[model samples]
Target: MTRRRLFVGLMVVALIVCMSTTLFGAASVRRYAYSASNPGGVWYTMCGGIVKLLQEKLPSNIRVDMIASGGSVLNTRRLASGEADLTMAYSTHLWECWNGEGIMKGRPNDNPRIMFEIYKSDHYFVTLANSGIKSMKDLEGKRVVLGPPGSGSSDNSRFTLRTLGINAIESELAFGDAAQALAEGKVHAMGMSGSPAAGLVEVAATRDIYIIPFTDEELDKIVSAGPFFSKGVMPANTYQGQTKDVPVFMFTVYQVASKNVPADDVYEMMKVCFSPEGKEYLGAVHPYWKTMKNDPELVKALGIPYHPGAERFWREQEQKK
Candidate 1:
């Protein structure tokens, strides 16, 4: 009789376990694709840090599969095609993609939603210190690598130079390759983005470099044309041979997601981004992230609508305040 009672109790427990599994299938691990820029870059570094934090804090159900990709332009395209759930992108790149301009011409990608704005990336005009190319006008008829063919720096350089009436003889080269070209005297100068950007750092290590400064009149001309560019400064000693603050024209960058991401997942993700642990980690990983925090104004730039999930999280935080 005791054996019979034990078997019945065991069966009841088994039945309870099955019922719980059915009710909590959402807890099952889910794999999601995340696209980041080239390995060792600002986007990849920040993406890696955030993904690591999420893996630790999020339920095992949310598994992020990250991929190294071509910077902002390609990342934005992937998000629009539903090929990726998350992407690292620049504000101006997507804005033009949405407006059917530049490389994304006529094929608008207006669907990706901002999860958070990360930092302002600036277009750095690098030349050999003794090159004597002090201004954009000096670039006219000179060899300049304006980022890789489809890169944000490439697009910005083309537009910026065009606006200033400096028609540089342009070449499309990756930042690292461009740096090599500059160091080897193959190119007169190159324009690329990011602070302490790896490519520039590599070149600065071997040769004396100078940052081409944008005069207030030059910056005013650029900013007057659109909201995409702003006047900013790269602090002194930011790079090798950089002795003082350099005036720069800047734009913002962001993490974008499909509007389809579950509201709860995004809410939890934002919490992790702002959590003391996450805040500490990202700032340590990248200099730009030193100022990372939630800001409603970050989303005010040109782009698609904010993720509803992101909106929900913001509302909850506001109430807490």
Candidate 2:
């Protein structure tokens, strides 16, 4: 009876202190700012999932906002300026931004925290069946529809093509606008990087277009060359005339944010994000959520320190293991 009373007294004291801290901390407002590449792309949709999850999990006073930007490079710039709390970034871009390569070009921003790996995006080198371009070598003289300037896919396509030794003239077309260019014969090939069933590929399917497969030698070279590279396949029957899976280069998509954000906020945000209740939310937000099921290994390869809040959430996940 004595011990029980002592335990109860300690619990009461702990609660009182917590309440006092809350009361004192009320003046310290927390505002979370997030950004994504396109206004209506997968990034915004997935961010909506995070927002809803965080809303239910965070303290009532915390504010969360999602903004739109041009692409990963722009998002990285915003993060560097401390303008965003969180954002979606390509793994390749993250590597480049960290190492000052590619579009980052000696302007690396190391002030970001890698929270988690979001998805694996596959590269698609698509063309009409009649275009007569059967391999990467065939694209040398072809007119290619690269993605919009400054978009993540555009950057990936450019670097990938250059690495593969293809030097086709690039047409600055967005994924949504590529079908018309292909149908008009203005371009012989279109380079895209996304999920196997991406909307752009669906559009191409309707027009009897399909992606070409990369050779095993090509896949091996990419994976051995960079931390960002991976192997992915577009399964058989995804696009018109595709009777077998198409091989392609792939890389992780990362959930990231500015390092200056408070650790506590980052923790709760990620807690809600990876919770069982958030699974359905993620699936509804993007089909790529299936890839997130392999998150443990993915997080291990995050290549940067997690935000304090995100680290706490990951620790809790580890406890469950």
Enumerate residue pairs that collide in model 2. 267-309
lDDT of 1 by residue, 123-213 (tens): 7688998898987778989999887754667777777888888888988876677888899999999887777877778878889999999
Angstrom error at residue 296, model 1 = 2.1
What would the TM-score be for candidate 1 when compared with the true structure?
0.85
Which ranges in model 2 have alpha carbons more than 4 Å from their true place? Answer: 1-29, 39-44, 48-59, 293-302
- Scored by CA lDDT, what does every candidate get? 0.78, 0.72
Can you write out model 2's per-residue Cα lDDT over 205-281, one digit (the tens) per residue? 56767587888887786677656688888778766567888898887778887788878777766766777777677
Q: Check candidate 1 and list the clashing pairs.
A: none
